[model samples]
Target chain A: MIARLVGDAAGVMSGGVLIGPGDDAAVWQPPPHRAVVVTQDALVEGEDFRREWITPHQLGRRCLAVALSDLAAMGASAAWCTATLCAPAETVLDDVLALALGLREEAEATGCRLVGGDLSGIRGPLVVDVCAGGSVEPERALRRGAGRVGDVLAVTGTLGGAAAGLRALFGRRPPAAAPAQVDAWVETWRRPRARLIEGRRLAALGVRCAGDLSDGLLVDAERTAAASGCRAELRLEQVPLAPGLRTAFPDAWGELALGGGEDFELLLAAPRPLLERIALDWPPELAPITPVGVLREGSGVSLYADGAPLPLPRVLSRHFA
Target chain B: MIARLVGDAAGVMSGGVLIGPGDDAAVWQPPPHRAVVVTQDALVEGEDFRREWITPHQLGRRCLAVALSDLAAMGASAAWCTATLCAPAETVLDDVLALALGLREEAEATGCRLVGGDLSGIRGPLVVDVCAGGSVEPERALRRGAGRVGDVLAVTGTLGGAAAGLRALFGRRPPAAAPAQVDAWVETWRRPRARLIEGRRLAALGVRCAGDLSDGLLVDAERTAAASGCRAELRLEQVPLAPGLRTAFPDAWGELALGGGEDFELLLAAPRPLLERIALDWPPELAPITPVGVLREGSGVSLYADGAPLPLPRVLSRHFA
Candidate 1:
């Protein structure tokens, strides 16, 4: 089809492309002394986001951020990104362009360039897919597969804040909905920061096996444990939930604390012997780094509250079904 | 908000990804390679495609193939890919899943891995976007700026077949509508092959200036000339048009020959001296490569029929105003 030619030509020539759009494939070279790491993700309106909850600009930023965070988790520095948007003709072209501008700003803020993107008129929900490229030295890279049986599982920043903030946006009375907590949670939820700096710090410390908590403590932790082939038993007493979260929705608080997604915090697995060194640079007061569990030579995730196993939540996201 | 976390975490890392997603800033390591080239593109039903014209699997393949063609023209390879799809809910999940499977198959056909991607629910139209990556050795990739004066412009495949096929699909009478020509044109248009092999061949031959003909011949040639700061003059008689195309639309044959798009052929410029040595593999039968024009030391594109300047028809596509 015409598409085959379009696809083939865009990636054809192997070399001699200072910047080719087609040939066998495409090639991108980052600066010297750096290896490129790539990441990609897609977002669909209604399922992944809502127009009522996010502006186009915010959506752009979020789309870019998610892909960027993958690089951060790998301890790689973002260099360039590409975003593709599919929307209806009735959608404001100006707003869409503005969203691209916002992406440019956010990427530039992180010293990354928003190099190129694609826009198309489609009949379904608006979709944005982003690809982020970063430069990282092989030695300093981190991976989810590097955790050991004895590594200590620590998290940076507060947990459940994003989930709590979401509840507020949805008009749900989450236990963490105390006025002050809600404000804090909403801010965290709306634009959770990317822990790029911490990733570099951890990398420098020779730490590996790290991931950002996007699918809540339970799901993400399970992913890490599964990927690393280890078992993790989280201590609920040690699990950090927003203050008053338990008091408000007494029944669901534990569920939110366990399965609430979108915390966006980094769940790191490090050797217990290095705890003192890890705590040196990061203080509990500034970005509270808490250890909630330990890895073991087994499988499955177990959550304990007051020394008893709690019932697992039936659903994680409303859109999943 | 959760999407923000997903976006931030799924992208590249920079030293400043502070609590990225849920933290302050994320930390990342700088790799050994720098300078990256990126591109993105999207597809939508009705505007660029129609379900009646192709199968869902073919549609998915075409969507990615078309976007990757841009990378091919840049002389690169696919390092990774991210795709987004938006379709109606009533649509069977398996159908969409089949599309994903097709995408994966196409990706594997080319030598890249599907690192990560996203999927979500939507309402009416079906949309997809693909972002691919390629790595170039320092100072080896080609760009659109290298077309020099006296360069011979060439193409890798036949032209107008796709355009002719479009007419045929709609039951329009065209010169190429005769059984033999119509079959060739329709088949070519339905699954136009990517000239990846030819791109590599050209790259090995040291051909520098090149681009895919996503737009019609005249338009893309003009773009190459304009972007390269040179004038291009093409002899109309030397232009290639499917045989049936001449027979089908004989009155406006020249317009269709030079202006109709969606051919996906590689319209490239080669140094003058390489013409003879380069043409040995031009094979006039299948994908007959031809020299239709020469880059001049001036600006703008001029057409010649029997050594006299000829008025050219505009070949254009939908672009945001």
Candidate 2:
């Protein structure tokens, strides 16, 4: 079944892929002298998505994007990907092919070849797992542990929209007047864009510490801090919320923005000097970079509002604090 | 959860692994100037194995072995692997950890690094998917399409043991007198070994066409034939039967040996001269090779018994022919 998917994966030619699916494995050549940054991520049916909320095609694109987000954080070029799909026996072949097509489209969008994968029957919820990798110059790849004590934290694009979209997807019918904004939020949740360009730009600008906002700000912030041996002091007032997120869920926007997760945006930390230079040369069309926090000589993450430490939220879940 | 597994994956370090699990992704430096062979394979709970039948540790080992088999077929030296697990929320942490330990053990045994992965909640049975890769010499890796019409087909190791083991596990209680052999067969099914060494030997010996017999001899032979644009002709009488398989089930041995998948053996097509040379130099420590078939100027597969064309098995499954 996996070998057959190679026929459907008619993707634009990428430089490194020497063999695409249908054999014992796919073979590729990484650029000479470049280190490979690899990551694997998965989305389960019930836990990650509801069938009624997202089409198979969208789910396909979303899965690839989610995995690619890690490569984005590493500031690696999109090169190749392999996906494993475990679906029920009753699943229609067309659905499987549609999912493959979704993967192909995403690969085309990112220039990552959908090289090879495995397919198997499952007795439960659908599972799509993708392993993505790309090349980065040795010793220059961004890492979470590379942050410094005085590094300022900045993020690509806004946050909380995907989480808000998830809430709206469940039971929170948006205010009728704000239906359009809610739809856009839902779209953001459905189709995530990996910040590949911004990540490269940051790396080129000499930003070495970075990670993706897959689990939203609070968790990823705490993680980056723990890895970098410092504290993430997030200034809530300075954090940029997704457009209309504050207006749609005025009471819960803070928690949603901090904890809602599913935002494929990147959070980067660099010396303020580099951050200033990056800001000065940042392209106007790219997702606007906004200062959100700083790495201090502490541990974990501390939330502050108006320069005063705000108590951590009771829980950073879909329910919002 | 994936980040936590990195703590459990204390593995024997192989060269080129710059990073292991944890962080957003794992970083690795492939052998400089070597092409990479990447493959992904998955084992879904219930469909692939019932928890009652195999221990979590064995399942973990099996999953990694299954994915590694593809790399083995490519004659790529195993380098690194990433696993994604989707387990029910009710799953015990110890089981998950045990599974990770299993993966680590297999990686240690094979000299592959269990570098990184992703963990997620699933509403259904557990699913473990692994993406494994290794470096191969550019333009030198074995491929299914490299066979010629007149090449004789040879397989490493005996066939049908794992499939027969599957039947034995399913209440086909082997003849009580053969309990010891039956037990060994069962072990073969529970713990698969990728023929990595033999594959590397084949490549070193200049064998260009080979693939793992994961879906049994019939399916895999057909696939290799199709990929090479030729027909496969097998002499059933010369084909190897797993030790004790023929005696245990004389009537079904042919079908089980032909169609029962998961053998994880390698089938190769090479010129007669190369086969003779390989046989002379084949190591006694490795699984014995047996010539069972030949590639011909046609499509599909033809089975012969005592020099007479034999009808293909009615069905190649646990039920036998």
Candidate 3:
């Protein structure tokens, strides 16, 4: 399979890709203002999703959304995208069109249009790979390398809902039903809101350090710290969790918040003054920007439960990793 | 496997994607640009390639080259690129770095960059998916829809060398031992070049109907005809075949030329006046553009073999559906 083939060739190619994978788009800065970004992610059936958990429409929407989220992380807007589809010949044309429609709708929401792509027949399972593009200004672009000492780290939304939703769907213990009110946690996993708006807002605020929290807060925070050569200390109490998550799985909600993946929210940082201004403009519901911690002059990332330093988990999560 | 999972969900969806997964790239005309061109192709080990046929570096270069061919057909410049790699966990680190270096070299050759990409470990086979981006002037972008009746068909490069190289490699007959020259044919298959210069030059000559001939000329010509609601009358004698192809397999050369794939050349059409100008500007060595046929105001594609209409093949050749 193509996915397996990709795994065979994927190794850490240091200093080869200026921007490695894991952004809304991957950019290569050519001469002049001709900068462009390309992004791709593959969604595999029974692995990335299940029909019982998502319809074709929602499935298509999620596939494009995740790829587009990479662009948002780079502080770039998605301009275009492509998809490679492999499915059985017996699949209905309407279902395929619905997938197309779903992709189109999500792409348009991000101000993109479906330009072109490929479709093929396969004997087993289905896979969709989406690639998106965007342009970046030379002077203003943000990257994982730009975090500074004492910069205030913040996130655009709360976490743990998507994992909770999965738990709810899988009927882990009590087989809970989805709540009727605006459940941000489940929504984050089902239909992640790419932080383009918040990215632009942060960009306007001259915040140079940023990344998306797709691989959970702790792991991504560790990455930011390692990439920026600074130590990130997060206030465990300040780290927001989904409203109902703590009540539902009281023991593991915190672990899910710290270690669960696929939240797709923005993790950005700025100096103290800019952080204060951002907190004022941010809406608590949509994106409650909060100061979780500071970037210290050191290496590696750490967590603080109250005033005591906590050990970071060593086991990598299966999904994002 | 991930491929099975992707195939099952068919595709992912979120709100706002306008057109996803069927075109060149997801075209989000966000803000400044009204039209954007994107393209992608995946190369799999034990399928599209073998280490004996290509180096990891050449594999990386070829992935970008194949995807860029689509951009070239659209008369666009190569701007950005991303790669998704799946390989073995124990693969040597240098092989991975060399692949990135090769991608970087090619990106620089075509004024592009290696932006972002993903890496993962899988059981077997290696797949490299290259996604590329380019920009088109909204007013002047070419498409498969613009092939007009009376338009003369043309091609940009020599054909059949890549397939010939495959035969030479596998020893279907006595192998060609002239290592230096035979290597060129092998390179045609292993490291095909995108005709970006030729595309821009043709576009400058007012040629708007075009497509890359990734799957033999016969198949792509049919695509142009079908999309444009016109019929293509290909002059078999006028088709350009590489020198050694005819000599090595004289009786079967025509079939190989007609059905063989992975030439990465352009198959386009324009008015007679425009054709003359395009021919004048196109490099004779790299492309040697030639007029091969004309579009009729009808449907379906056809071939004229020895001054008689012949039954056309329905399916394209290997690796492409």
Candidate 4:
């Protein structure tokens, strides 16, 4: 059965993959003069998703996107990925095939290839672990430790949509919003896009420090700040909320914007001048880049609203606490 | 808790790892003129192992070893590894820490660094997935597709040990073997070594076709044969059995030798003169390399005993079927 799945998924190899699936290990001839960026992310059933909320296909695509978000955080080009799926023996074959198809589709969409992976039967929750590898100019690669005290903190795309989406997903009653509005939020929750192009653009535009907003803006910002020996001072009003988020959440929009995780957006830090220049020359095709904060000469993260200090909300961790 | 474990296991980084754990992704500077070899393997709670049979530390080491074996099969020098562990929320934190310690120990022993990984809570079972990366000269990397007709089939280290060890583990009654002998088999089952040095030696000796015998000799040899478009003919007498294996399972020794999986040894196909040369130049410090079979002008694998064709044993799949 494993061999059959691999065979069915064969012949989709991209250039540079010397040996794809069906080998002991996949070999890739990486492009010369670039360092490899590698990251591994796993999503487990119940913890990462509920079957009722996500189709197998969406789960597969989301898993790859989550893994690739790390590469994006590193400002690296998409290259190849390997995935391991641990499912129960009772899992439907078509569901597994659909999951694989989703993975292949996402890989192709991102200019990456699913070169190899493993499958196993489990007596536990379904687990999808993906290891993504990409290449970047070593000196130019974005890093969390590169943030400067005076750097302007920026984010690509609007935030808080996934969190809003999650709220809509688990709400006892349907959201008091238009059907299209509810659909948009649900879509954001189901299919968050990794800002790969925006990340590469940031690297090319001389941005040094960055990370993906998988753990929400506050936690990820704090992490970047801690890594760089600085503090993240986020201006709440400057945060670009997803359309209708303010209207949907009203009282909790601030918490959602600051703490809602799984956004998969890129958070970047660069000098004010460079950020201004980037904003001026940023391509319209990519997600809009918004300056939402600044790196200050301190440790930890601080939030401000209307020029007044605000206490950080105690948001529950989305995964294992 | 995750951060604490990562920090405690820190400082074991080897050179070439630019950005290790705690970053969004790990970055490594690969040596010039080498292709990257990557492989992923996962172990589930009940499928790959049982909690009673293996300690958390052993499980961690085994997971990394399983992944590194694929790199070894490609004759690649280990560089870095990332692992994901999904445990139930009720799992003991100490056990998780011990597992990380084991992973660090094995990675250091293999001259690779633990770069980055993910952690999540699973409601069902424990899952550990490891991804290993290494570098090898593209022209010299061993591949199963390189096998040719008339090539001698060889393997590194003893066979049937893991299978015998597994039998000892699952046996309801104590085996008739001596306690010391039982201990050895159980050890082999719990801690299989990846033949890194032997694989490199084979590659250096110009042997191209190879694969790790994780699925026992018969199955892996058949896979190699199928991949290379040749037939594998095994000489049962030539197979080097684990010490006391025949004495332990007299009637079943043949099946154990031919069908036992989890051996974690290398199966290679090379010309007779090359095999002889390899044997002559084999390093005394590495695992012993022994000739076991030959490749013919057909497909599939065949077994022989005392010059008579023997039927292949139907071995149950060790992993998910």
- iRMSD per prediction, in order: 6.4, 2.6, 9.6, 1.4
Instruction: Please provide, for model 3 over A186-293, each residue's C-alpha lDDT reduced to its tens digit, 9 standing for 90 to 100.
Output: 556688777776776677668887877767788778778876889888888887887767666766767777776677777776889988877776755556676788
Where does model 1 exceed 4 Å of error?
A1-28, A31-34, A173-183, A242-251, A283-287, A318-321, B1-37, B171-176, B179-183, B252-256, B281-287, B314-321
> How many clashes in candidate 2?
3
**Full ranking by DockQ:** 4, 2, 1, 3
Report the C-alpha lDDT of model 2 over A196-299, residue by residue, as the tens digit: 98988888878899999988899888989988999999999998989887777767889889987787899999999989988997899898899999999989
The global C-alpha lDDT for each of the candidates, from Candidate 1 onward, is 0.66, 0.85, 0.67, 0.86
Candidate order by decreasing lDDT: 4, 2, 3, 1
TM-score of each: 0.84, 0.97, 0.80, 0.97
**Candidate 4 clashes between residue pairs 3 or more apart in a chain or in different chains:** none
DockQ of candidate 1, scored on C-alphas against the true complex (2 decimals): 0.31
Model 3 ranges off by over 4 Å: A1-38, A45-53, A88-95, A121-125, A135-140, A166-187, A315-321, B1-36, B45-53, B88-95, B122-125, B136-140, B166-186, B280-282, B313-315
lDDT of 1 by residue, B1-321 (tens): 322312435555333221222221222222234234456677777767767877777776776677666656655545445566666678786677667766767766765444445565666667776766554333444556678999998876667877776667667756445577777776666665555556546655677777777777888888788767899898888888766677777776677667766777788887867867878766454466788999998888899988999887765462312
What is model 4's interface RMSD?
Answer: 1.4
Model 3 alpha-carbon miss at residue A42, Å? 3.0
Candidate numbers, best TM-score first, in rank order: 4, 2, 1, 3
Judged by DockQ, which candidate is best? 4
Residue-level error in angstroms, candidate 1, position A105:
1.5
Write one digit per residue (lDDT tens) for candidate 4, span B291-312. Answer: 9999999999999988999989
